[model samples]
Target chain A: MSTTLNPGERPTGYLPEGADINRNIAARRLRGKIWQALFFSSLVIGLLALGTLLYTIIDDSFGYIAVQTKIDPEELSDRPLAELSKEELIEILRANISAGLFRRFDRDEPFSERSKESVLQLIEERVIGREVVASFKLTESLLERERIEATVRERFPRARLEFHSWLNRDFLTRPMSSVPILAGVGNAILGSLWVIAITMILAVPIGILGGVYLEEYASDTWYYRLIETNINNLAGVPSIIYGILGLAVFVRALEPLTSGAAFGVTDSNGRTILSAGLTMALLVLPLMIINAREAIRAVPQSIRQASYGLGATKWQTVWHHVLPNALPGILTGTILSMSRAMGETAPLIVVGASTFVVFFPDSVFDKFTVIPIQIYNWTSQPGSQFRNIAAAAIIVLLVTLLLLNATAILLRNRFKRSY
Target chain B: MTVAELSAVDMAQANGRYAVELHNTHIYYGSFRAVKDVSLQIERQRITAFIGPSGCGKSTVLRAINRMNDLIPGSRLEGRILFHGKNIYDPDVDPVEVRRRIGMVFQKPNPFPKSIYDNIMFGPRINGWRGTKAQADELVERALRGAAIWDEVKDKLHQPGTALSGGQQQRLCIARALAVQPEVILMDEPCSALDPISTLKIEELMLELRRNYTIIIVTHNMQQASRVSDYTAFFLMDADRAGQLVEYGPTEQIFTSPNDKRTEDYISGRFG
Candidate 1:
């Protein structure tokens, strides 16, 4: 410990007996600068890590792919497959493929009722299916275009070669395919939409209501404390546990209800969109409640006092003042939770989300496969081309999550400015 | 004028001159008593001030009058607070209804997070005012006028109530309290957070509000009490640190002539 006296200068009592006051102050300032630098570097490191993740996903999505086809498209058709009109494509498929297959297509969906792009896609899938044999990253595809073309020509003379981006407009609308090049994320996107919609619908109202009960209505009893403690603990529980619970309860015991067989939906069993949605709802319920409670707690006590002083009942005070003020924070938490639910793969997988559904979910009872499941399925395949498509699926997931977060940020800011 | 002097203990013999009467009231938080044996009469249509040092529970007693203490968890009130010859603490008597008849202004200005118009209309709307748009507008104007903040905020009625300056916000709170047309308004150190100019404005407004609303204010400012209040109650903390009233009388008599030496010393700035 240092005790000191200074003449005509500010007395820094902590200064050492013979230490120069200015030097000590300077040393502390230097230490502060070092701490500041360390903090700033940590921020940069975080940003760098995030950038690397996004870059890796994006780089895999676009590239050169050397594709091999079983039969030459020119030999079967009058022109290139890409040059044919949608009607011509459909006509060729109808004439070429077996009657049984054509009948199956009709049973699934009428070709005449399908749009031009869909008809073209069907022709490409059923008739002129292409196989992706080799793929290259974005940088190689861009910088070594001539070399890539030369290598493709030398390697497989009969195979078609072109610059291909795994991510395209067709990716959003096309159904799952065994052939990686022909695969699209349409079914997975639709399934993700269905499950997320159901999850949010089931989670938000119930979570917020539960929060209101805990924060406003419930007294400090042992029961209240127990429930509060359990909810707080549940937020940190690994999501896969919820998946097991959902499988047991929603998929097995309540199979009839979950599968909508009670509603006479005989096509799907217990492994349906409803079960996955319910599972996700259970997964996010604690998170949503915790966030809502925090938002509600952030409301000033004086505001509640003001409302009470004005003769408003508890419900009135909560509805008009507390909830409105807490709404922005609540929405931010809900959006983040929704993003978590969107990215969740393990829970849906356990709850029996299909990994290879060709059709979009028509109802909550329909078998479903969300985007993460699609990516998981694709990445597990031995084909390097499948990894490319998986990366593309990751891009889709990221974009959707980003859009959701952007909307949340916009909504929060709007509320913040007003309140 | 000493400690061992005659105590003019007038226990709630208030017939009708007082708008509110507390008889042997003790305020407790959970199991801890905050104020003990507080018995006082707040006169009708006049400003009565509860003046005391810090932690003396002047605010607690004021909050008890409108049952605002009910908002606190585990808070209990002993004895009776009579409003218009009715025991407000009766189980059948809803605290919300009591608060409706007797509104409150907080120490810090707490206007609702709403437009100025909505802030004033919150009470009336909740009280079930089915009126035309023009009528709602007129009511907002009238309330704002009553708080003497109409001219400054008339054109900015659509703005957020929180955007107002500290003084304007306090006035806005007063306007909000006045909107429901309550018979009494309890102010808890309403000017303590304000500048001297704003304090003067609130004090002057209190005098103007005395014609209709029975106003009881809790303040640490002795000069404010001497200037605005008709009746003054001096509360002192007892051995248990529980606040109890030591003197209650006309403001002039209590501020100038001594009833208790303690009150005299407090008035002379010798001690609080």
Candidate 2:
């Protein structure tokens, strides 16, 4: 407000002189740069953490392994064991193992019914008793291949060094086992599907209906406001708390319903797929309701007015106009919630999902274990082989999540209409 | 004689004389009164225009005719808005039925994100229209034709109504209202959002529609009211900021020889 002039002629917004102005501009520029750098660094840090996670998972998923056998295959066959015919392999397996063991294999799946590859696998598993003596990560396998081969040859002459990808067809198809090489995520994958299906079945309709009621029908009164506030708060509550609630309600109180006892079936208890799904449903219900509410709220008020002006009833307006306009957004939110339910582990564990389920859940009443729980179990085992399998399972979970998110994106874009 | 003077005689000869009559109506949002006591009769099958400045409650009054204000929370109306000699505000009278019979076109074109055909059919479908496919198509065509937008949209009837230009979308919305066979059409600044050409088009369409349906339009433009309306109502906000009707008469007299000083002042652009 200063100027070198008479008071009557003084300017209202006078500039400070050049040097001070330049300094101020420079200081502002420097401050802007600092904030920009800080924001960029935060982004870099987040990306670096995600990059490290992916690198470790990939590193553990493939590598080299040294396997040793108790009985040499050369001693059991004249030629290479891999070159032996299925009959020769079976004969060698019969001659080496005990009579009762061979009889048990026959009784389980008669030799005539078994495939050649199955017979060879049985022979390698039972007769040869191949065991992984050492394992190396993907990076170490490539960088120190010669050293690994030398160490394997020097330590165990019968050991065979080979490159192995933990995420193989066999690992995906075989049932879970105590033996690391024989373990697979097949059963866990099935359990995850069943649990998620039931979760969606229970949560989706209820969550959407609740959202519609809140957004469209309910009056803006203290109680409805209270309900809205509690729903918002419930979405942020810890998932494990939901698990405890599910345990008390679905597992203990509604045990008969969840255990299939109400339907005249009673072989299993309440710690079944239905119970796990119900728990996961409880964990994701708040999220679903919040997202659905947001989607429904995004529908323009003008559309509702237009529908009502056409002499449509409240239900007709919501069902025909509001719902169709909100569908894409609702589907996107639902799928995102489904992905969240797919990856949740704490709630399922508290609801009693088994850590080592070998059998697939064929019904809602059967026992279940999801992929994340399987990874958790594997990572805790005292072996690098288990770590590799855990990494593979993590890859599966990531792929599933990615696919679900992709579907959400596709549905949104495909149905997105400009108004 | 001018068309306005001729219609005045036709208005006298009509059996019912009026399509709608408002008896000392006052509109309120919550406790705040938006429109003060006002009463007027709308001649059957004629276009009536409400001209006023912004926030003068002209649109509010127009919406009250069809009970569109019911959608707004805490909005209430006092006195009676009569249609077919029955007060529409009666508890036994369903707001939905009133809306179906007295349709509205909004200030901005708000066509649903649906095909042109579907947009027109929505009103009919919701009203339990039980027609064959061919009959449905005929109904759509008649409604579109009634809005004077049939040719522009007939080729692309399956295209989304929202994909049309602003003016076309507005016409589509009018067509949608017509599909329900409403006896009255309420236009709340329908041409305010359109270009001059589109505004002229809508004005012409309103004149055509007046042959079969009673029309009430709220507009800020005085010329538009004088051009299209058989009867014109002028409103101005009072010291309390509540809108009150300043004058109601034939459009020609209201413009040329207004009885109220405020109407003359407003028409002469002295002040709002």
Candidate 3:
């Protein structure tokens, strides 16, 4: 039955009565625009945060660069200053004003104008071949080598200098210095390397073996279930707890083997590299075990059955078929765990890692300080210069972490199998 | 009902030679029985098929023959399973050695995550078969050919076994089983996960395998039982919490002319 519609509700040609096509299109466009705006805004926020962080680090680090200076070889070797009486030494410094070695203040010049620390620094850099000054000519002409040498000689006559930057050979060879210019990370670098080596050696085998036992051998009874639950819970436990355990057990309980003052130190406190390493190992042990268990569990049960069906013993199946398939995943997990151990500081601190160590650890029992601890120490100081040192240390740390993560990712991608 | 009646009955009908003999076998999981008082004879160099509805003890009986059921926790078996005229469950018999002689292929194809060549060589290597590399290679080729998979996978033998299609993977598994030269092969629905073409290929492979190795297979497909097996055993769930064999005979007799009415109804698709 056909019915007549009211005049206000009449349908247009080739259109459904209730449809508003333009409005629907507009709504769809509005949703698309909103999504686009959200995506762009999120990206902008991320970039802005990154820029602010970088700006802050650079600004703080600039003060350290300003304070750092190279010691003039001639000044260090000056015998006249040592041999002369105090009155003669002061007169000699006054006579070398034209050489720009020292600035002499007269009654006419203001205190600010008479201060020559900055100018002396610039002149020393030029004399030492550290700063390059370009010579401009009307035509493109190379200055004669002799003339260029003479020009440099005329600029500074009293003192001989050498080219040096804030980052120099001494920065890599020397230990942390009270003088900012002489500070280096060589000791900390060695300490970190030793800690990581010992941590991996201690953690990997124990973690892997425990994982194999839990996943392959142990019955799924209440006892094994309890162990599994405890391992997962341990993974979430704070790193500082492991430190306390190491301090109490390895430091005090096993004192006979690890506590002797063989390194010419009298303190019986367990602040050795071995103690810190063992503490770090305990911190990441549960992480390694949990990841390894997951990797082993991911191996298909069918493969195990197939091996067993071939008359291969249970051990044979697990060793040959199951373990090989799970190796890549295990390696990935291990690398990630090692990365955590590498960067961990809280546990080492609790275990008494010295923050002011000056020498490389000669043995596992020697006191040590790692890069993070060194940076942490530097950051706690009152001067902004030390904060810059910490920032530089952080850059080194981030680069090291990046290299390790890249290697892990590369290994995982290289050996990844579909099965 | 009595020893005298059983002995009298045995004396009247003990003529045919059997490769495997299961006598009053009962299987249990913890306190629950899964197969009860099952007795059967598996003839030598023959393809035997066990067909039934889900959880009817077809696979359980098949696993019991090779002592594969021992792998399952809490599983226990009563009664005797005699292989080569000796009790397979004897305390002196090593399960590993027993399994070496009686290989198994599971319902799903499970090729090792290894090169196709390695998957076939794995069994021999583990069993301490010392031979020249050339000899091992030749054996791998022969085994693959025996399973009718050599032609398709010959050029790609170095590729990972898991890279093959499902059907090829199953054939590779069969070849791996054959590599160890088992006396009896147990297949638990070996072709259930395959397509029609692969299933027919597997059935043909079973028929060819019967000339050398005794094969026992469990299948849900009724047509497969009629197409390939020489002997057929029909199992049905009984009220005593375990499955019982309703009938066992030549394949033609079981399919076209079953003695038991239950077997006939199941074969005709009237009821399962």
Per-model DockQ against the true two-chain complex: 0.56, 0.77, 0.55
- For model 2, the local distance difference test gives 0.91
User: On TM-score, who's better, 1 or 2?
Assistant: 2
> What residue runs in model 2 are displaced by over 4 Å at the alpha carbon?
A1-13, A16-33, B1-14
> Which lDDT value does model 2 have at B168?
90
The CAPRI-style docking tier of model 1 reads medium
Superpose all Cα atoms of candidate 2 onto the true structure and report the RMSD in Å to 1 decimal: 4.5
Q: For model 2 chain A, where is the 10-residue window of minimal lDDT?
A: A1-10
TM-scores of all candidate predictions against the true structure: 0.90, 0.94, 0.77
lDDT of each: 0.89, 0.91, 0.79
Ranking by lDDT, best first? 2, 1, 3
Cα error, candidate 1, residue A111 (Å): 11
Candidate 1 deviant stretches above 4 angstroms? A1-19, A69-129, A417-419, B1-15
Clashes of each: 0, 0, 0
| Chain B alone, TM-score, model 3 | 0.93
- Clash pairs detected, candidate 3: none
lDDT of 3 by residue, A23-84 (tens): 77788899999999999999999999988776655444332121112434355336633444
lDDT of 2 at A50: 99
